[model samples]
Target chain A: MVESKHSWKAWLYLAPAIVLLLVFTVWPIINTVRMAFLDDYSGLEEVGGTVFNFGVGNFIKVVQYQRFLDCLKTTSILCIATVPISTILALLIAVALNSIKVLQKFLQTVFFLPYVTNSIAIGMVFAAMFNIVGSFLGTENELVVTAGVINNVIEFFGGTHVNWINVGSTYAANIFVMVVYIVWNALPFKILILLGGLQSINKQYYDAAKVDGTSKGRILRKITVPLLSPMLAYVVITGFIGGFKEYTSIIGIFGETMGPADASGRLNTMVGFIYDALASNKQGRASAAALILFGIILVVTLINLQVSKKKVHY
Target chain B: MADNNIVVMHERQMNKVKTASKVGGVAGKVLTYLFLTIMALIILFPFYWMIISSLKTLDEYRMSVPTFWPRVVMFSNYAEAFTVGKLGRLFLNTVIVGLVSTLLSLVITVISAFAFARLEFKGKNILFAGLLATMMIPGELFTITNYGTVTSLGWKNTYTVLIVPFLVSVFYIYLLRQNFLQIPNELYLAAKVDGTSDIKYLWKVMIPLALPTLISITILKMTGAWNSYIWPRLVANDGVHSLITNGLRNAFTETTGDVNYPVQMAAVALVSAPLFIVFIFLRKYIMKGVSRSGIKG
Candidate 1:
């Protein structure tokens, strides 16, 4: 009777959150699936009381679209390329920071700086670093400009300046720039998590290794990595999920184009594809694309979990 | 005598090994520091560049070789960026949205958390599990339908649109619930025996005990408002309702397709200042909130 009395009061307390969640979250999820199945469904037309046939038309359209394929490819390449590289780099950095006592806190704070930054703002800063500032010189408007800081640094190192995200830049070059920016943005949080994991690890293991005269490399591989596997798995799984949804970082660099001016949609990811569809009022297609992305993330996450379960040591 | 000689030789060999190991350890430490210093520089360079680039003149900024430091520092660019980007208005809008949404969300979170934490609710376990499951689905999926929902409601170009839909963050509710549960059940039971009302008890005891988590939630929610771009861009991107992130996007590009790099950088720097300040002052809370959630994606 007491518990029953509290039930209604609990409902009262939960009313506001539940109401908003139902409208905004639960309904939206169901509506996304519903809209995805509705062939050629326009939200505007639906509001005007137009009935729509339900079919696989939207999914078919999303699959057949060339831009969507490009988005899929871009997303996959980014995920594959970035996750391993960032994970390894962050692992090494975290381990190094863990080993050292000198300036450890300072370096950790510095490394964690990007975690607090606005991605768009930092993305713009990255864009400027790689951007070529040009001026139209003659009547023909031949562009003359200064190389960006990245290019200047390359030249200083006796390498030629490459057009990174500019017009006429190669796909590989553009992807390279995006990878660098993504990795830079990703490092701080990973370092934070891994460092925390490293710190919480017992010192007895290291002391035992030292007594046995174990080499640093062997200890890192055999002891440190196995102990830190759980955090690494978490980071890698989250990294893939985040990489699939890569949008704002691209927006920060390329504005709304998602690519260089001459090559719009070249660097577009799955989320960007959905956004483009929504922007054009292709709600059904956008929903389908979003579902596709969700499916991919689900499959990937499951695979990651399976692999981690087998390989991760406790 | 031969055994003594063997012992002396063994001791000499051990000393040599000890010296070698000591040297190796020093070298390892030096290498670690060197690597960390370089990584730190790589991380910090963009910020340094953003500052220097913001201070340079347009001509200087466009020079074939980028200047490590601006030859002529342009202090007026910040003023120009402030007016040109209409940063003041954007700042005002962001503050309004951030505060209103954070406060309202806090109330909802506290009450909902209390309910889930203490009150014997039917279907409580299922409801909490369902909420946690939603964290797996990408938020972009929601945007597709929510855009339609908001548009049908005629929420375009309004602060209400910006503040209302995001008022119920399942993550914050979950975070606060965990915090509320940490308050000993004895206190609640004692209050109940004394005929104290649940809401009154929650307000007086639970909230004060869970202040740290509440504070963390507030900071995280405020920062979320500051960093949010996608949803706001979808529904309320007009001049009046646009938040700072959307406001800064495309604000500096000229009609000729040339961006004013210096002024844009200055605008970015200004836009980023508050977040950096918040981070510097409230880093512990922010970090605690982030690490606790671990679902930022």
Candidate 2:
């Protein structure tokens, strides 16, 4: 090894990245922690207040805010619902793609399309697709899924036509749309990763199982799942992390207001809540909310890591 | 005669098993193809809808039962989308920001990666570890305070605000450093023996060897710039400075609150065209880069 000595040249090379990190990343980390404890940093100038406070007032305020609590609930439900579903869907699709011999590359490209497109733009398409009825409250056919084809199919199949994103509608419709979007959006990268993992697994296991006349289901359960566990663990962790920050897709589907403008916008996630708080001069509360989100993510990730250590293969 | 009869009977049973398995295998293959075809249709349906909707008239788009394909094929919607939505300005702004940021970040990422991979420095391991740890923290934490910092700096609605705050990606740095590390130490030593300069070796040898990864990083970075919405929306939602994603929001909405669906779809298609093109052409790089990083991590 060329054990080069300590040199100013290395520092020169590192200075730009390091400086940017300090100003943009490192400093913000400190500022978040500092601001989270303060009561009213955004309004300090008007009140001539100090920026430092060791009290837990900001945290208390965040917890006390009804909207913040609702945002947390919304965020949790979306994450819990979307993550597993997307992961499992990705796994199944990846396995299928792996098993097939013809047009593998073609199918893979089609599936990966969503990963590259702008989420918000595609979200607009979804909004339009699910917007059956197009503001005509009463229609000739009460059973029609008005704005798009999805509802028409639902109606054609003897299912009741439900409003997908109407302000007064139940959470079921919103959740169904969000889940479909998230899973579709999430599938590409997960499938790509799992496909790579699948390819890397030793084929000898399958061959050996075949020689022993093992059933396909048994082979997949006993051999394939364990080998793909590492990738599964990766997908789940990243999915949860990405799911918690589910702001843009909502914006894509609902636009900048984050949900239907008529009602109080019931679909706000934690990040969206923080952003709203910041926008509305609730910087102290926003900081507290951000820190709390950070705490939640860290705790969840650590727990995931612990679980993966036991369950993940290699 | 009895032994020969037993052998023939056993051969017949084995042949029957082979035929049954072959039948099952063919059925399974058919099922796989059928499932893939259906899934592909469902997956690509939105894209299909986007295209046909862009060709629709406002009236057709609002039809109680939407047409699978546009009736009149109103291509004028694209013109309206281009001019009315101000997509030209958005595209120019996005391109300028994307190029400037990607170029600058490339420089920073390459140099930093080189240092970490090849150079011996005090506290390198600890610094790299710290950087990696930061990745685990959600970016929402940074946005909380970065918003204040940028606002205080008076950078609102500026190109600098769009490009600078997110330039140094630890993931890119880590990715490039891993690529650089794979180049054997012997190569560096051999170059040093010839009195080759570090910068020259990096430019001449290391970079070329790592071109695939660098290309991947560049594509990813630019795509990121194109897709970015939240930060850009938060800081630069001003009409003159907005990125395409933020600009597309309500761009075609009438004062009466009814969105011109056809025009909006046209605008989305226009905004999405470049990405689709990039995906078609450079997908291998994107997949390779992502998978490489995922596997390593």
Structure candidate 1, residue pairs in collision: none
Which residues of candidate 1, in runs, are more than 4 Å off?
A1-3, A135-143, B1-20, B253-257, B295-297
Question: Per-residue lDDT for A123 in model 2?
Answer: 88
lDDT of each residue in B193-230, candidate 2, tens digit only: 99999889999999999999999988888888888888
Report the C-alpha lDDT of model 1 over A1-314, residue by residue, as the tens digit. 35566588889889999899999999999999999999988887887899999999999999998989999999999989999999999999999999988788788889988887788888888888887766322357666577788988999999978878777778999899889999999998788889999999997687667656889999999999999999999999999999999888888888887788888778888998898889988899999999999999999999999999998988
DockQ of each: 0.49, 0.46
Worst 10 residues of 1 chain A by lDDT: A135-144
Please report, in order, the local distance difference test score of every candidate based on alpha carbons. 0.87, 0.82
Candidate 1: TM-score? Answer: 0.94
Q: How big is the positional error of residue A199 in model 2, measured in Å on the Cα after superposition?
A: 0.8
Off by over 4 Å in 2: A1-6, A43-52, A134-146, B1-20, B250-258, B293-297
Q: What 10-residue stretch in candidate 2 chain B is worst by lDDT?
A: B250-259
> Candidate 1: interface RMSD in Å?
3.1
Model 1 residue A76 CA deviation in Å: 0.9
Alpha carbon lDDT at A120, candidate 2: 83
> What number of clashing residue pairs does each candidate have, in the order they appear?
0, 4
